[model samples]
Target: MSEFNTTAFQPSLFILTGLRRLAGSRLWLGLLLSLMYIITMVGNCTVIHLVRKERSLQEPQYLFLSMLAWADIVLSVSTLLSVLKVYILGLYEIAFDSCLTQMFFIHTSSSVGSGILLAMAFNHFVAISKPLQYTTILTSSRVTRMGLAALLRAVALMTPLPILLKRLPFCKGRTLSYSYCLHPNVMKLACGQVRINILYGLVLVLFSFGVDSLLIAISYVLIFQAVLGIASREGQMKALNTCLSHIFTVFIYYGPLLAITVMHRISIRSSPVAHAVLGNVYLFMPPMLNPIVYSLKTKQIRTALRKSCKIQRS
Candidate 1:
């Protein structure tokens, strides 16, 4: 296979690369990324462990929550590896095959995370709206099936992305401004028109992120309606409290996502630094915040963590 030379096509003013060049040193970025990765790993792992050990939380809701934690773990690890490869190893240029592999995992993890969130929403919906049927509707087998389905859907949806990207001729710039090989960044390198890649990406985004988000919204809407119909203020408050963690997490995940989309579409001269910063937030912020949200909101998780700590000390 003939590889395209990318030296001449390098952007003279790639904002992300320029920002990294000017913003002190790669050392700082490496240290920051490493610290964040460590925190994400510890926090998400703790959440997963607590959920797994707690007999009370061994239900469908917690099952999906654990899946979300696993997705975050995968995403955080892949992202950290890519960042370290660029900033610490000083290997900014990626081979075609390596880039494709990275893109595959990144997209797969993202899609899986979104799917897990939808499963969580459905769990909440059944628990709240159809309490009588909740147990029957979200059985252990059903939860397992949903999880497997989410994984398969994520992989199947993203399988074509890398192949499509590989088919494009990188006759243009090869230096991806960001630390990782994101779809948009890779698409920018195509010498030939990439209408197909863009269209396919948009379609996947709609099905994966956009559709999942909509379902989450609908789930919450119905949940809220149910809460409102309850006569007692205490009942309403309790119902709202159950969902606060999910709401916070959804916002953290989607806020930066929406910003990235708008920036990509509207901003002609967006800085690579801006994009990179937003990209990092979009990927890591939810994982970092999720544990905090759950810990603060759920007294059960906090008590479980304390008990787990005491057990570890013994």
Candidate 2:
């Protein structure tokens, strides 16, 4: 761990610190992650398919749900090869270029997911507060632009990570903390000063999750305020129920993330297994569960699914 050098750079391979040679838990972890990957793909793909198939689902809310599904699919896919190789095939060494690519996609897709949640929150607000204007406000063209904007934001923020790390020499051992590459974990492996990388990583987290969470909270507050004014308990419950799925999705996506961050800061001495389990939970839970929550809770999605199933059977 010395200062920065002026020599020409050569890439080095890094190993993923997957499940530490559990005699049996290793097998179980592989099977569990495999199942999760399958479920995530199927669940999210179904949502996207249904949103495309049903005419009634062309509205803004379901449109955003489909985009979220797409982002989840990308996120899950970004980790699948590396994670499965580490856990199942016992392969650990990843080429530096590939690792950089993996890190870029992982961060960008996660950022895209956060942005999508913010979009969903705003969609819920518009639907709840200004029902009549929802269609006019969130036109299909506007929704398309929003999706593109989210992707662009992710790309802009994460583009610097691999480049910055490339410049620094990683005199520290080439071992990552998890089965996947994250900017925070990877940057810490660099030898020389990494204040710039650390600061930029912090900036990405704050802008992506911090700001989005705050906006979501504000949206919910306004939505609840409008719901409470509906004058009947049943009507109030109905209005509030519309937000339950989005709220739950947000919780599933961000709750474990926040918990992990808190634990990292406060319990610097926590067990490795605890961190591993929580990281897997944060990685796998939202993409696998989001579609299920929406399909079960949202009448339109459920009804469309039922009709689609009956048509296929007939």
Candidate 3:
């Protein structure tokens, strides 16, 4: 039998490019990403803490918000060290398995975030459409089930990524496009045929991100329809106001993802710096912005925060 092709070598280590073009501006980028990471951590943690400590925030909507916060925390943390290593410490060597693990968590947590947002959209619909039965429909137990299902779905859907990636040979250069591992970014560096990888990624994105976004949009459409049926404009506006935070959140979550997905397709002609910047934005913006948006827009969160502060001060 012919010996295995010598050219198809698997690398045990992958090098993260880590915004190489910005080597001249590493300090500013490092400081900026570091501060953003810090804020992401602080903001998400504060949301989780407030949700746990405050009785008024024990409702389904707030509970789902807390789940989103938890996912954001995990999503941000998954990439934190790797990014710091690349930007701050000038380290690019990540073990293959370590890179795979990071990729799994990054994608899984993002999926989890999407799932939680879908649940939140449903919560908004239920609250507006059937106010009298809002509590009854989204009881504590049901909310728990919803959250659990979201997480389980994320894990199940993302579990194949690392396994599939490990089976592929990587004779291609091992330099990754980003400081962290992404399924597409890593797969792009694999040698030989990668049609399966591309197809699988597209399928995953369709079933996960694409479906969730569509469902969330439909939920809002139904929500708007319900609001329009109300007799007075003020009442319609009030009902719609309740969904403002969720709408903002959906925007932040889906907008960057859509941009990144499109960016990957056009990456050949796109500026490398644009690719790096947008990918980081896609990862970091939602985590950093979600809590701030809620705190500013939602009355209940503010009220709960004030009460929590008073109790703690006492």
TM value for model 3 = 0.95
Which tens-of-lDDT digit does each residue in 20-81 have in candidate 3? 68757677778889999999998888899999988888889889999999999999989999
**How many collisions per candidate?**
1, 0, 0
Candidate with maximal lDDT: 3
lDDT of 2 by residue, 58-107 (tens): 98889999999999999899999999998888888888888999999988
- Candidates sorted by TM-score, descending order? 3, 2, 1
CA RMSD of all predictions: 3.5, 1.8, 1.9
Better of 1 and 3 by lDDT: 3
Weakest ten-residue segment in model 1 by summed lDDT: 10-19
Off by more than 4 A, model 1:
1-19
Angstrom error at residue 63, model 1: 1.0
Residue 208 error, candidate 2, Å = 1.4
